[model samples]
Target chain A: MPQLERLWNEFKDKGLHIFHVESQGTSEDDLKKFCRAKGMTFPQVMGQGSFSGYEGGSGIPYAFVIGADGKVIWQGREGYHAVITEEMAKVRFPGLGKGSVAKGLEKAAATFAQKNYGKAMADAQKKLEAEKGKSSADAAVVADAEHIIARATAVGERLQKKAENAKAEREYAIAMATYKILEDGFKGQPFGDNAATALDAMKADKEISKEVKALQQLDAMLAQLEKAAADEKKKNLKAFAEKFKGLKAAEKADQMAANL
Target chain B: MRRLGATVLSAAFLFAAPVLMAQADLKGKDAPDFKVGSTINEAQALSLDECRGDVVLIKYWGVN
Candidate 1:
């Protein structure tokens, strides 16, 4: 647990967001106290995690590393210290540690940090090409530029594949969400443009749009239900499941209602 | 009562956490949303949806 805390301290600003979820059915109050006692600063989610999709193995102390592209990249109970660090290193610009990026790549790095992969890559590469043999730090600057482009391209590709896979499986919600990430984060990049086109195409389909709306409705309702009483949640959830019948999110609503 | 009831229901899950964390098998799988009670240590609780373009480490822990 302390190790995870240390990891968070090391990379919190580098696109690493940690959520300390309470799965032992610990009350929110107790969860807060526990976190306080340990001086932990990451966000803590108090709930009985369904542990859905959990194939079951190492119980408790388990983890799931969802990448910047919204795909689960790594998961395990232990021995993942290196994996965690390595995964984080992928997101930090210049494909390096938490150090300040090279001076020549500052503007590009700022763009990348803003989640603009296409522009950042193009900017960095253009700068790299222009710097061919001008500076004494040619080798170092060239390396950073290449790393940024490669890493950005990799993230964009993975998200493209994930969105495609989700759409192919008719998981509209996941597909739409991923496509949005690509559209917003990739900019003029190839995969990012492809995702944007696909997203526009998806919105044009009546059936797909309906499915997406149903998902949005479910998410909005769930957000509302968070503050609601148990009895109220049960009642509302029943109505939602019946109304949004046949949708996965509605099925989830059913499960939540039953558990309530 | 709402909070207490949630605690009780979450406890029932004690006997049923997932098998093991399997990144290899679960890669690209849509992670199911877990029950959320409150935000601790942060101003707002983060849903998986809000984590796009960011790597989120969901550490499921327990304390009696």
Candidate 2:
């Protein structure tokens, strides 16, 4: 884990991304604690959707690396370290890199890179207005500021679409998270307002609210499953499935019990 | 996609083959997009294409 953390620190500026996919219902608190203790900074999330074409090997720490071209470049348990090193060297981000940012726009660019789109847009907008019609140096700031605005706007729209798709698919948790980001993160934006309206309408739906409650309760129940002994956890899961009967939550619980 | 431990992996041959098959089947193809079932630290879900044109590593792991 520390090695992975080191890799992240070394290559994050070079555009490397590492994410931990935990399928076994480890509580967010526990996962955060574990990562903190290990000094990990990369995103760690629970698994979803048959891993979208990748296989979950029967191992604790196996990994798969996708190249900048979005192809599976390397995959294995611990052997990935050196391979990642090699793959990292091959990356060449077009028109963007750590050193490409204009000095005047660096701060805003940093915020944008951190995914703080709201703050990034605000800061960049200020720079854009100030630098507009100024000298050649100012033109650099103006260009980067416009780039930030364009990227952030695109991301906002994409998230809005993602939330709608999640809502249609009945994946309420994901829909809510995406909407909350749009609503809170993009506060003054039109997309944010739309997301807020969509979220309110969804929450008002009786069927959606009922299912959301079931999934939340199921998440709460699974938290305890992480600590119990093997046999006890199985028994508890069976009971859980029955408890959630007739709801989609039951199917998820049933899958866990069967896995056990 | 089911359980997250070696015990579950060995217990179910059903999962093992598919994982190996996927490794063989999907190599070099545009990586299939993974979903955020839930986030452990992030505020929102991310689509794989969100990081398009950058190296992304998915480390599939378990607490136990």
Candidate 3:
């Protein structure tokens, strides 16, 4: 993480950004403490979904670099500092190896490719704002940034529609996943807010509430049964059998108890 | 001996249950978005969208 911080410092002016995502259910306070303890300064966000399948998702400390063209130029589980530096070097502006406005465009392209539409749009907007009423070269950069914003917004809307469709079909899990994509993938956008609203509505549904409770009960029962079966004491086994006597799993519980 | 064996088998099964839970494959795919408050700036909420247009390095970790 310190390596990443160094990299962020080195390339931030050249249009490099780092977003640290906290996985494994760590609280914000603990994450802050960790950052303070490590003297880290890059921006961080808490992960909303499982990090099981993202780039280098097989494990922790995964990274991916997106080119200004909105494509993933590099990704890996380690050595991101070296990998990103090399990739950024390749995208260096003409006669300007680092810290150039052109390089910002390249970074914006990469962000768009990564599907971080909101950030991509913002970056492009910033460039346009900074270059307003400047030279023709500046105008070109502004035009490019505008193009990125338009493209990113279109893609975001498409994703939002897909999430809405999933909700319409009553595919709660799929809808939730899609909404999550919009909520997280297109933050600060209308789609993101729409996704949040849909999710909140789902949480308020009585049927979903009942289903959640049933699943929780089932899970508790399974844990109890597993514990009772693993116990060597005959008294515990008999007690479990009696406790679950009216339940569907009671027969299996009894059989396991008898084996004890 | 039979009772002991049964207990050992059941214990093994119990331990394996969590491991059997599903793990999604997210590598080489577009990263998902999430929201978290920033430690550097108090009362500020941050999200993945904020890092757009730059090379984003995300580390998923815990304090252990």
Candidate 4:
């Protein structure tokens, strides 16, 4: 963790964002205390099932380096500082790294890469608006700002179209996934609201609604079964088994419940 | 609660918490985006998708 702090200090000026996520089941206060004691000042957020989905072994101190293209460039359990340093050095923000306007542009570029198109566009516009009538050597900065705005706009449109097409085709899962990207990735934007509406409609669909309920019921039954087995409360086991018998994975659930 | 705590602690220390020496399956794939409450500023939330374009290093850690 200290090594990560070192990396963040060294490369933060160069557009490196280090985010520390407290893994599931860990208390936020404990994580905050740890960070404070370590004198770490980078952004820290709670992680929800991020590592649980990792195909690699689930362990503490896992790190992933995501590039401007929104793809994972490097991921590992250790040596993140070295990998991130090398990656950061390779990024060349033309006409950035100096001046307030350039800094704003740099931030805009970073926001654009993160798929926060609306924020990126708004920031770029603000920078450009501030630079109006000021004849400084900010041509390159202006050009990059314009480019970010255009690219963000184009990407936002593409994502919207993709989601719409998926919904039209009745590919409910794909449509929901795409809308989720727009909703969460571009929150506060019009597109995000649109995605939310689409998601609500998708959830209202009868087939999808039924399937989701079944999954929820299965999860509840499994939880109850686990609790009953742990407490050795055999009386409740029969009721759990009866409930499991009606679920999709009835065979496995029934088998486990029967053992209780 | 005790059992859950034990399971969580075991998982946290599982595999020696080693720096992943092996190549990650997610390398080169689109990083999964997430939004969670921020400790730095409780009123604000942090999202992975908002870090786009910068070199974002996400460290998953446990206090235990």
Candidate 5:
């Protein structure tokens, strides 16, 4: 392990960027201690959930060898340093090397931060689509990553709206939703001072209550629909009937018939 | 030569595959088996076996 760490430190200066992906359950302190003990100075990452996406899935210390075209050419499980070292040696140096996906992602994140929504969306979509079939051993983690990225993109769309046309109320709502998505969706992300300030501004606004109420209404409606679906599946006519009672008389009749 | 290379590769995987497989299942399932010091100020190794039969709180953070 010391030898591998030394090798990584020696070659990291020459386009060997290491990205550590910590699992949802893993303690960051352990990662920090391990990295510090090994004298590593690489970017450490955390996931939304367990292994959910790539065909094989990914976990801590997994490595990706992305091609010059911003596509992953090689991906390996944890502690497979020699796979990377040997492959990188065989390939040309100072050239278009691996980890284009990470680079592409970093570029997209930068563009998003700069409020370049159009370019950022395009880059994010490309990066996500390109990672379609790759899987690590864990399915849940992969699923969480996919779900988190989707939620992030949706939040980005709302934020993009706020960026383009700054309607006070809409911006406030979008900003609040964005904060929640970032906080809940991607744990341990470096949400800088700007996000903090924007959230504070939104919280102080008077119209926040109205937006909150509206969101509550949406949640209630969704819960109603979910309960209705579940009741119908169980053939619980009384439960289904009770759930549809708040609807208009005609709509109630229609729902009752649908359930029947 | 080719057979020797295959044998070496197979041996390396046999030793490393389970560790890699376990690491890959970090999210969704119960957290991975890890033993870290309980308190930041302390130097005790707390393993999952020690925390068994109890609800354990797991927190992930970046140290500055």
Candidate 6:
């Protein structure tokens, strides 16, 4: 809050416009209360009603810095952060702090590739914090966070795949969660196009890829046995028999029955 | 009643506090409008629409 206040104070003379986008649910009341509390002298919209145009293709807190000709000088993070601010910083300031934030994030990504998670996270977090009214910092943080997770997960899956112990469904779930976070976080940014791309990849849920199908089949068989054991332990013998009979792998079913 | 009065007074002050500072000039274009609770001599809302005819200096002073 102090950071936000300082930003407003510092940039007031620079024709900086701050628009708060409101949506339905818990965040709605928060916006109203924030408006009242912040003494926002500028225009704010209720967002749900006639204020939709201000929302652009996305929703609230998504700011745009427009040039005098009505062209979007900066569109907030469609890929990673607030779209308008990101676009604006690159277009307007070019080589300002926002640019540095972008460069720092790129460097951090390189560092992460070298197995320096601590340094990467620190560098990314610092850039995110120092990123003033500029949207680049926000985009950098979002991208870096997702990049770190995605890279780490990919490496884990790669090692597991090489060892013939990969769990396809587990990989899918992790990827899905990563994409979901990115999707939610990029709401007001101009990075909508990139977000859509990432979302599509996540939604693919490629569990049946040829390289993973065997592992998935084995995992399914193991899971069935585990469930049977759990049911048996719970004294649900009838359910356990039903589950054991339903096993798709005949070998696993026979093995389980032989054990029983 | 006291709580209600305090709430109203606080809201009024919050609403008026920024206005007390020099507002950015809104000379032309649509003047933005904002509303607050009841206050003495306070317009029900502040709108750039009201300052339409003259040199409406609309100043944007805040984070972008």
- Tens-place lDDT digits, model 2, residues A53-94: 666555557678887677887777778888778877665532
Instruction: Give every prediction's interface RMSD.
Output: 6.1, 4.2, 6.4, 5.8, 15.9, 14.8
Judge the docking of candidate 1 as incorrect, acceptable, medium or high.
Answer: acceptable
Cα lDDT of all candidates, in order? 0.70, 0.72, 0.59, 0.64, 0.43, 0.38
Candidate 6's displacement at residue A64, Å, is 2.2
Model 3 root mean square deviation, Cα atoms: 18.4
- List, residue by residue over A1-260, the lDDT tens digit for candidate 5: 46645755665534344334444455766665656545555445445332233323323334444322233445554434554565454332221121222433656544443434445455666666656655642444333334335434554444434433433444344457666544443334333234455567767866665554544544455455554755453354344435544323223334434533
Q: For candidate 5, lDDT tens digit of each residue in B1-64? A: 9999999999999988876664333332443444442232211113343222222223222233
Instruction: Please name the candidate that would achieve the greatest lDDT relative to the true structure.
Output: 2
Order of candidate numbers by TM-score, starting with the best:
1, 2, 4, 3, 5, 6
Model 6, residue A256: C-alpha shift (Å): 66
Q: Give the TM-score of candidate 4.
A: 0.42
Q: What is model 4's DockQ versus the real complex? A: 0.24
Per-residue lDDT tens digits for candidate 1, residues A108-160, read 87787777888888998898888785756478788878867876786687678
Cα lDDT tens digits, model 6, A14-82, are: 323333333443343455445544544433433333322333332223343433222333434232123
- Candidate 3 CAPRI assessment class: incorrect
Please give, for residues A41-91, the per-residue lDDT of candidate 4 as tens digits.
787766544433343455667778877666788877887667776777555
| Residue pairs with backbone atoms closer than 3 Å in model 2 (clashes) | none
Best first by lDDT, ranked: 2, 1, 4, 3, 5, 6
Q: What is the TM-score of candidate 1?
A: 0.52
Report the Cα lDDT for residue A3, model 4.
69
CAPRI docking class of candidate 4: acceptable
- Pairs of colliding residues, candidate 4: A68-B53, A77-B19, A77-B20, A78-B19, A113-B52, A113-B53, A114-B52
Interface RMSD of 3: 6.4
- Error in Å for residue A64 of model 2: 11
Worst 10 residues of 3 chain B by lDDT: B38-47
Where model 3 places Cα greater than 4 Å from the true spot, the runs are: A50-57, A90-260, B1-53
Q: Once superposed on the true structure, which residue ranges of model 6 sit more than 4 Å away at CA?
A: A1-4, A25-32, A35-43, A52-61, A78-260, B1-64
Error of 5 at B51 (Å): 41
TM-score of 2: 0.52
Candidate 4 Cα outliers beyond 4 Å, as residue runs: A49-56, A92-260, B1-24, B41-45
Assess the local accuracy of residue A205 in candidate 3 as a C-alpha lDDT between 0 and 100.
90
